[model samples]
Target: MKIKYAIIGAGPTGLGAARRLNELGEKSFIVLEKNSYAGGLASSFTDEKGFTWDIGGHVVFSHYEYYDNLLVEILVDEYLEHQRESWVKSGKVWVPYPFQNNIRYLPNQKKWECVRGLLPGERSEEEPANFFEWIINTFGKGIADHFMLPYNFKVWATYPEMMSFSWIGERVSVIDLKTVIKNILLERDQLSWGPNNTFRFPLKGGTGSIYRNLAETLSNHILYNTSVVSVDQKNKIITDSLGNTFEYEFLLSTAPLDILVTKWLEKSPETLINAADMLKHNGVIVVGIGISTSKKDSRCWMYFPDDNSPFYRVTNFHNYSPNNTPVPGQGRALMCEVSYSEHKFVDQNKVVDDVEEGLVTTAMIDDEDRKNIISRWSINVNYGYPIPCLQRDEALKILQPALESMDIYSRGRFGGWKYEVSNMDHSVMQGVEWAERMITGQPETTYRIS
Candidate 1:
């Protein structure tokens, strides 16, 4: 097939690009999707027992008006809005979301330890060298030792020393001793500290519903189950696993940038090869523990820092929407997330069992509740998180421009290899902005190389 634009992967970014191109009255593009479904990592699945599960715990919220309008157009009133009720599990205590801001909820000794570490001269006065140093220097050794260090290692599945701390803008909550003391004295809970303080979710299809609906509008342009095997950048050609070939003037790949460069791109040089090697990512295993019983927990999700749970976080999935459970308003869908990487190897074969036992250890479910467990569904995501590794920026600078010079643009979560802008909103806008830039001469903003 011949086309003006060929987009790879039908996730938020590809769909966003396709949708925007269509809206702009451009009709000569095709979207080749590997799976029979849309949404990529954002996709959801329904088990035989009729329980819905997202790839992981995905909450719907946006920083882009374009994405906000896109949701309004796609979902209309079919979604549910909820205030964020996120928390952390520390010393069998349900501390508020930002663990640092709510250390006062800890047992008296641990609480005192956290406060003492935050005192003047406790933190390093020198600039941090890496994420680990930054955590200790900015948050003090106590908070780092108690929560930041352990929880982060569990979640990211990569050593903090290997990661750069620049991506901590809106993702992490900063602490101040004055506010921490005031909150402790007045007993104030810092409930809202991040962008997702209030978010939305699909009332029926889990989080994937938005992408599914958006793709439907451009169904004629999307070719499902067509996986791109190789890219002939010199000839502007693409060959899929089905033995079909697509030729395009421009290509937008939402697949992993490493996969695109190292595996797919034809005749790639050593510089690009080494650059792709530096791109670090973590895998996630989503274990959905569905119980035939119900619970009245208002907290949406809770983070685990201690060894009580193999998982770093668990969601009260039932609270996301009553429809998430088989019988509305009944049963609990406790979705647990366990991240793994080579640096932190997890026995995937036994993670489900570990997760169930961890739930018991953390007091999320009782031994009696285990008897009530009806569904044990799990999905092993090979590429769950795109780690902002020490060499990430250096890698992107070398890879993105080299591909763009060949009229290929890689954007979105793994494509851009940027966790900060990997949210649903940012992914979609990356596509939308890519389309806009293609149609007109407007420069892109969301996925900048720098």
Candidate 2:
């Protein structure tokens, strides 16, 4: 008897799994997407003026060759490779990224404080119990106290002490003392240190184009506007929102683990319930501002670590592609700003006003620049960045095996609930590898930290 499979969620992970199944001649599958379209959090939308904006902001950085190979196969001729130019805005200083390494730009007293914190001392035999301790140990107290602690609070919407350090492998950069001193002495900007030194973006049609291409490949098997409302693991049946039921031999769920356990499992475990309650996520408010300036050259994305700006980051969406906004002769530049918070009941009008005020305060736009404002729109995503809080690992440890026991594999950014491997490339490869594992019982590289 042939094995039948049913995939829940039409995001990158589910699509990847479907692609892999197709390649292996396994046609016994159906993709159920809740939304009217594909690409979960990574989807795109166009405003009334034809400007393209992503859900928040997404960039593709891959560590796996298979991921790259598959993208090349699908995207074919529709991708643009870009070098990353990122910076942190602290106070009035435009410090280079890995702000700790560029402390020479700081005051002498602060510099000395950092050095004092780094003096070789009695190392703790025990491991760091929280994110704050881990950062202090890795970058010293100066960097952590000055930037890491405060900036992270703004971004993650949680206190550092409340977060765990187990997710800090390649996600956070660990500065080398020798290199730091050398760069500071030489007054050099260490631009080539991290995983995102060079990356790719879709040349046209925005980041969603990649997903659109993936969906095009499996157009026949994908079922849009079909939301999975419940699942009966014991009976191997999934009921859609429209009251249609489908049976399968295997299940791949990319939905939130909390919802799956609460609604699908036979006897939801108390441990899983507790884990769900512990899981905390930050919401994102993405504001797209279209201006009427001829300044063709602007930084790709700027980091706002200062209090003046409510947004944590801003991407010059037009810089990615001319098509991302109106044409140069026809219109002006476009900027997309992202703000994160844990609360869901934030007033939309208030957020818009705050964002506009922040843009002017940060000097991204002038006070009298209303003439340049051609269009403005906003999108709010409830699950933006997965907070690596102290309880995250405990939740995953208990929830992952429970889902697996029901023959359901959940993978992707929100699916696995991992921010470390939640980039476009990582999420897509997660889907690919999950399929390979299910087909051949192979180990998944994305799940392995080393």
Candidate 3:
């Protein structure tokens, strides 16, 4: 097949690109998706027991007006809006989300330790050298020791020293000691912090429903169950696993950048080969535990920094949408996430059993409530988050330009290799912006090649 544009992967990015191409009345384009379904990392599945599970914790919140307006047009009233209710469980104490801002709930001894580290003379005055140093510099040693360090390590599954803190932008809450102390003195809660403080979820299907619906609108232009194994950039040809080929003027790849450079390219250069090596990432195992009517917990999700939980984060899925359970509002769906990488290892076969035990150990569920467990569903994804190591920007600078020179563009979570702009909205906008740039003379905003 030959086309003006060839989009790989039907996740938010590809779907957004294809959808925009259709909107712009561009006819010569095709979307190739490896999965039987759309949504990629944002996809979901319903088990035999009828519990729906998203690949990871995904909430609908937007930073762009275009994305906000897009969701309104797509989902209409088919979603639920909720104030973000998130918490962190540490030292057997439940602190509100942004653990640093709500240290008042900590035990007195530990609470004072957190405050002492934030004192004027306590924090290091040096500019942070890495993510670990940034944590210490911003939150002080007390908060770092008690929450930030361990919690971040658990989530990233990569050592902080190996990461760059440039991506924290709005993902983290940088609070002043005065705010922390004032909240403690007044016993107040600071729950709102990030862009997701107010978010939405599909009323019935899991988070994937939005993308799945978008894919449906572009079905005629999509080739499902197809995987591209090689790209002859010199000749502008793409070859899939079945040996089928596509000739294109421009190609958009939403696959992992490392794989694209090292594996898919016909002749990868030594420079590109070394650059791909610097790109690091972790895997994620989302374990979904659905039970019969456990005591209600209003918090949307909770973070676990201690060994009490084998998972780093757990979401109250049923609270997001009762349809996540077999019968609406009849039970609880606890979606647990555990990240793994070279720096961290998790035994997959025993993880579910370990998660169940961790749930009890962390007091997320009562010891006797195991009998109410009705369903267990899990998905293991190899390319979870793109770790923002010190070499990321340098690597992207090299990889992106080389591919663009060959009329190929890679953008998405792993495609762009940027965790900061890898959210659903950002991924979609990357695609939308890319499509506009291609069809018109407009310059892209979301994923730039600079």
Q: What is the TM-score of each candidate against the true structure?
A: 0.99, 0.92, 0.99
Local distance difference test, candidate 2:
0.77
Which window of ten consecutive residues has the lowest lDDT sum in model 2? 328-337
Q: Which runs in model 2 stand beyond 4 Å of their true positions? A: 1-3, 107-113, 120-126, 264-267, 296-298, 328-346, 448-450
How well does model 1 score by local distance difference test? 0.93
Clashes of each: 0, 0, 0
lDDT ranking of the models: 1, 3, 2
lDDT of 2 by residue, 96-206 (tens): 676777776766777677666666772233578898888788777777777788778777877788888877777777775676677768988766657887778887778
Please, what is the whole-model Cα lDDT of each candidate in the order they appear?
Answer: 0.93, 0.77, 0.91
lDDT of 3 by residue, 1-450 (tens): 999999999999999999889999999999999989999999989988999999888999888998888888889899999999999998778999989999999999999999999999998889998999999999999999999999889999999999999899888999898898899999999887889999999998999899888888899999999998999988989999999999999999999999999999998898998999999999999999989875767999999999777799999998899899998888889999999999999999999999999999998888667888989888899988999999999999988998888888999999999998999999999999999999896998877766
Off by over 4 Å in 1: none
Q: How many backbone clashes does candidate 1 have?
A: 0
Q: Give the TM-score of candidate 2.
A: 0.92
Could you arrange the candidates by TM-score from highest to lowest? Answer: 1, 3, 2
